[model samples]
Target: MGTVRPNVLIILVDDMGYSDIGCYGGEIGTPNLDSLAAGGVRLTNFYNTARCSPSRASLLTGLHPHQTGVAELVNNDGPGGYPGSLSLRCATLAESFRAAGYHTHLTGKWHLSNEREQPADTWPTRRGFDRFWGTISGAGSYFQPTTLHDGETPVPLSDLGPDFYYTDEIGTRAAAAIREATTPFFGYVAFTAPHWPLHAKDSDLAETRGLFDEGWDVLRTRRRQRQLEAGICSDDATLDHRDPAVPAWEDEPEQKWQLERMEAYAAQVRAMDRAVGTILAALEETGQRENTIVVFLSDNGGCAEELRSDPEGADQFRRHHLIIPPTAPDGTPMKVGNSPGISPGTADTYTSYGQAWANLSNTPFRRYKRWVHEGGIATPLIVSWPAGGLTGDVIHAPHQLTDIAPTLLEATGVPALAERDGEPVPALPGASMLGLLRGGEPVEHDLFWEHIGNAAIRSGDWKLVREYEGPWELYDLSADRSESNDLSAQHPDRVQDLADRWQRWADAVGVIPYGDVLAARATMPTQPA
Candidate 1:
C-alpha cells in the first residue's frame, strides 16, 4: 500500500487540446482532473513537442526527441535525427527509476518503438519497465486496437472479452498496478483517449448528447472567457480568429454528424477523467496519496486532420494507415472515418472530431497539431503533490514537456543518469522545474522546439517560430499567449538572434531541414513487405 520512497504517476493523453479539461476552461466534464487542479498547481504556459511520438520521447528521456531517435513518428525518416524508434542511447524515466530500485508499470499507448512486427529493445518492457499493457502502434480502433500487447507478448482480440474498452481497461490496469505495488512505483498511464478514432461507450455518449449541439463558434468563445476567469491564461491574452479553413457553424452542411463527433470526443475525455479518479482512489486507499506526485498533461494540441466524409470510410482508414485495424473483434465490418449519416460513439464506427471541434478544444490558441504555433504546442499541466503542502494554486511561468523527467527524478531523490554503458547519454535540454512547482521563483532560459520542418526557439518572453518553408514569425508570449500579433517585422534583430539560436540547437540535436528528411525517405530502399 505504501513505501519509503515517493510514488510517481504520470498520465499522458494523446492529441488533447490546451483547454479541453474543465480546470483549464473546457466545458467537458472532467471533475476528477478539476479536483486535482483545484487542489494542485495548474501551469498557465506549458508546451509539448507538437506531435505524439516526439513529445513522448522528450518527456521520457529529458532530451529533445531528435537526440532520442524519435525525430518524427515511428519510422526512420532519414539519417540525422529521423530514426523514428526510441534510441537506447538515452536514459528513460523508467530506466532511471528502475536502476534506482523503483518498480515501473505502463498501461496504454506505447508508440515509442518502430518494431511493430516483433519485440525490440525500444519497447517499454525491454526498456526497464516491470509491466506493460497497451498498443505499439500510433492510432487504431478503440474497440479492437492493432498491435495490442500485454507486456512483451501480443494480445489476441478474442481474449479482450465482451465488455472490453481500451480506456476502461487502461484505467483499471493502472489502479491495480498502483494498489499492488510492493515497492516505490512509477506508473505511466498513457491513455489513447481524445485522439483520432472518436469511439465512446453508449452510456458515456448519452451523457454527452446535446452538449456540443451549439457548434464550435459558441463553445470556443465560452471556453476562452472561462479561461480568463479561472486565471488559466494571462489577462492580456485574447482569442484569435477561427481557423480560416473552417466554416461558420451555421453554414456547415453536416450539423448532426458534427455534433455526434464531438459527443464521442467528449465522452472519451469524460471516461479518461473517470480513470484518473480511479487511479487517485487507489493511491488514497493505499495511503500513498500524500507521498505520490501525480502529473497530468496532453501530448499535443487537439488534432485537425479531418477524416473522410465519404461512404467508404474504412477504405480511407486503410489507405491512410495500414496499421489501423480493418475489422472489429466480432469479425463484423468496422467503419472508419467521420462520414455523414453515420452516428459516431459506437464500436462499429471510428471517426474524429474534426478541425472545427479541435479549434474549440484548443480555445483561443492559433494553429493545430503538427505546426509549431501556440495551438499545436501549448498544453495545460496539472501537478499534484500533497506532500509538498499546498492547498491549491496556479504556476504562471512557462515550461516544456522535457522538464518533466528531470523534475520527477529530483523529486523522487534519484540522480540523473549521465551515461549508458560508458557512452555519454546526450545532454538534456531541460532543467528541473521542481523548485518552481514548490513555490520558488521561476527561472528563465531559452526553450527550443522542432517537428517536421516547423521550428521555434523561446528566449525570455519572446518566441520565434516558422512553418516548414514559411517565413519566421515572432511573438511576445508574456502578453500574447494566443500568438495573435506578429512582432517579427518590427524586431528584426531579435528575430535574427532567435533564429540563430534555434539553428544551433537544431544542429546540436541532429535536426535536418524538413525538406531534406522527407527527400531521404523517398529514396530509401523499400522494406521487404
Candidate 2:
C-alpha cells in the first residue's frame, strides 16, 4: 500500500446563499473560511441540488438525487425514483473511505432518511459512518431539536444541557472524533445553522445587533458591488431585479422587527463560522492541518420560507412534529414569525428571515431556494488542501454536488467500487475536479437539474431553465450570470436541443414525472393543524 492518505473534512452549512460568506462577496465575518479560500482554490460555478435532502444525497452518493432514490424531500412517496431516502444502489463516500481504511465520522444534520419511522437500517451508522451525532430531520429548533441521535440510538433531551447549541455541539463532537481517530479520517461536519427558527446565542446576536438596520435593498447593492470587485462575478454581469413578491424595503411594515430578523440570521451564520474556526484549530493542534483537505460549501441557497405564527401550522409545513410552545432558558413562551413586537435570536422565538432578506442573501441571483435558478442552486465551494499545492486561485468550471465524492476519492487515491454487497452500484455521473484545481484544462460536461417541476440544463456557457409549468428561459451565463436576459426566443434551436438533452437525462435517471410527485404529495394523509 502507498503512504497513508490525508484526512478529509467536508463542512456543509444549511440554507446558505452563494454570496453569504466573506470570501464570496458577502459582508459576513468568516475569517476561517476566507483564510481557506485565500490558501486554496474557490470554484465560482459549482452547483447544488437546490434543496437540502437532494443535495445531501447527491453529494454523498456521487449520483443524481433521483438515481439515489431521493428525488424529493425525506418522505418516501411516488415511484422508486422518489423513495426520499438514500438507496442501496449507490455507495456513500464514507462507506468507500472506510473500506479504504479511513475512519469515518459524521456530525450534524443527517436528513438522508425518513425520521418518522426512525429506521435503524437507514440511519448514518448503517449507511457506513463509524460515528454519528446529529438530528435525523432537516430543520428544527437549535436549542431543543427533535430526533437527535448518536450512532444507531436516539439521544434523550435530558442528556443535553443549557449550553447545548446544535452547531457548537457538531463542531465539538467532530473535533473530538478527529482527535481520537488513529487512522486518516473522513469527517463530515454538517451544520443546521441559519436555516430557520432563527435562533442564536445572545453574545453572537449582539455582534450584529444593528448591522441590518439599513434593510435588504442597501445590502443587496453593496453585496453585488463587492462581488464585482472581488471577481466573484464578471464586471459586465447584470444584477437581476428583485422578486416582485418581496415588498420594497421602505414599504415593508415592522421595519425594526425585519431588521432584527436579518441580524439574527447573520448571527447564526457568524456562529457557524466560529464553530468552523474551532474545528480548523483542532486540526492544527493535532498536526493534521497541512495534509487534510478542508472543503466548505452550503447545501443549497438561502431559504425564503416564512414561519407561520401557529405552531401546529408551522410543524405541518415543516413536515415534522415540533415541540409545541417552545421556551427559552428563562421559561418564556416562544413567539414565531415576522409579527411586530416579537424579536428573534432567542429560544423563545421561531422565525425566518423572509423573502426580502433571502433576496439579499443570494445577492445578484434571480430566485430563492426550491427553484432551479442560479439563486437556488449556486453555492460557494472552497477547497483547501495545503499539501496539494493549491493557492489563492479561482476555478470557473461548472461542477455539481455529485462531483464532490468523486473528487475526494481521487484526491485520496481510493478506487471507486463497482459493486457493494453483491449489488451493482450506479456509476458516478460527475468527473473528478482535481485537474481543474491544479490549473489543468477545464472539465466540460452538460449538467441537468430537476426539482418538482422546476428544471435547468447547462451546456458550456449557455443555460436553459424553467419554473414549474413556465416557459423555457435561456441565458448566456458567461455574460449573464444573474440570468437577467432571456435568449430562448433568439435561439429556439438551442433551446429545443438543450431541453431535449435534459429530458433524456431525466428519463435515464428514472426521475418521476413532476406532476406525479406533486400528486403523490397531495394525496398523502395530512397532519392535523
Best by lDDT: 1
lDDT of 1 by residue, 127-178 (tens): 8789998888878778887789888788987788888888988999999999
Residue-level lDDT of model 2, residues 494-521, one tens digit each, is 9999999999998899888788877776
- Give all TM-scores, in the order shown: 0.96, 0.96
Off by over 4 Å in 2: 78-81, 310-319, 322-333, 527-529
Query: Candidate 2 lDDT (Cα, whole model)?
Result: 0.85
In model 1, which range of ten residues has the least summed lDDT? Answer: 313-322
Candidate 1 global CA lDDT score: 0.85
lDDT score, residue 253, model 2?
81
| Model 1: residues with Cα > 4 Å off, grouped in runs | 1-3, 78-81, 309-316, 319-322, 525-529
Count of clashing pairs, candidate 2 = 1
